[model samples]
Target: MEIVLLEDVKALGKKGQIVKVNDGYARNFILPKKLGVEATSKNLNDLKLQKANAAKVAAEQLAAAKELAEQIEKVSVTLKMKAGEGGKAFGSISSKEIAAAAADQLKLDIDKKKLVLPEPIKTFGNHEVPVKLHKDVIAKLTVKVTEA
Candidate 1:
């Protein structure tokens, strides 16, 4: 039996996909769980429309992310930390701190996980940080760490 998947099903298919499965499985499991529907002519047409709509939404989101990346790349964020006379910080700064600083300074809400810090910063200086805006979009941010 042919069915249209409403959501991703392990070992079967992804959302909006038309797949052929055993009639018993389709009737007993997929339909009952609201994961899929019978692939009738009407349902097939609806699936096509749904896929198109999803693609359009995804494209718009990608464009927005790209624009955000460009804006982020153009700005430099400064962080004030307590440091010693030799320019060594009293405490290390992590990605979470940087993310919070970016949000507080730039008014942009960025996730800490998206801040790519290979190692904690322990000195006062200027550094370049990489922020992942999207899977295909990344921005290099300039951060200036000053002694407070």
Candidate 2:
């Protein structure tokens, strides 16, 4: 029997996939568990429409991410930090601080978790920060740190 998967099944298929399984398995596991439904003609048509809509939304998101990446690359964010006489920061500049600075300067709301910082910055200088906007899109932002 053919069924439309509502959610992903490990080692089987992903969500919205139409797959063939044994009749007993479909009736006992997929249908009862609400993981899948019988792939009737009406259901298949609805699935196709849903898939198309999802694809359109994904494409739009990708385009927006690309535009945001371009804007981020062109702008430089300045952060002021208290530094010692030797030019070392009192503490360290973390990704969270960078994210807040970016938000304040660029007027873009971004999560600190999305900021990819391999390590916290200790010295004051210009550094390139990578922002992961999407799985396929990465934006490089220039951060200039100066003594407060």
Candidate 3:
């Protein structure tokens, strides 16, 4: 029997995949558990439609990510911190603070998790930070740290 997987089945196939299985297995296990449905003509048409819709949505998301990356590249976030003796920063700046500063300075609501801070900002100077807006899009942002 040919079945279209509604959800992933370990060792069998992934979701939206068409696999051939034994009649007993399809009727007893797959159908009854709702893990898959028999691949009828109507079911195959539905799968085709679903795949087309998914592609469209994915393309839209990629375009939006690219646009955000461009805007992020043009932005420069300034962060103020207190410096102690010998011009040493009291506390290092983190991704959370960068996100907050971006929101305040540029009016961009960026998620902290998307900001890549390989090391904490510990000195007062200009630094370039990488922002991951999407899987394929990365933007360099200028961050200026100054004494408060």
- Clash pairs, candidate 2, are none
The candidate scoring highest on lDDT is 3
lDDT of 3 at 79: 94
lDDT of 1 by residue, 1-148 (tens): 9999999999899988889999999989999999999999999999898889998999998999999998899898898889776766898788888888989999988899998899988888999999888888989988898988
> Worst 10-residue stretch by lDDT in candidate 2?
83-92
Model 1: worst 10 consecutive residues (lDDT sum): 83-92
TM-score of each: 0.90, 0.91, 0.94
1 against 2, candidate with superior lDDT: 2
Report the Cα lDDT for candidate 1: 0.90
Candidate 1 RMSD to the correct structure: 1.5
Instruction: Give the C-alpha miss distance for residue 43 in model 1, angstroms.
Output: 0.8
Off by over 4 Å in 1: none
Q: Which rank order by lDDT, best down to worst?
A: 3, 2, 1
lDDT of 3 by residue, 51-116 (tens): 999999999988999999899888799999999998889899999999999999999999989988
Candidate models: Cα lDDT each: 0.90, 0.92, 0.93
The numbered model that scores best in TM-score is 3
- Cα deviation at 67, candidate 3, in Å, is 0.2
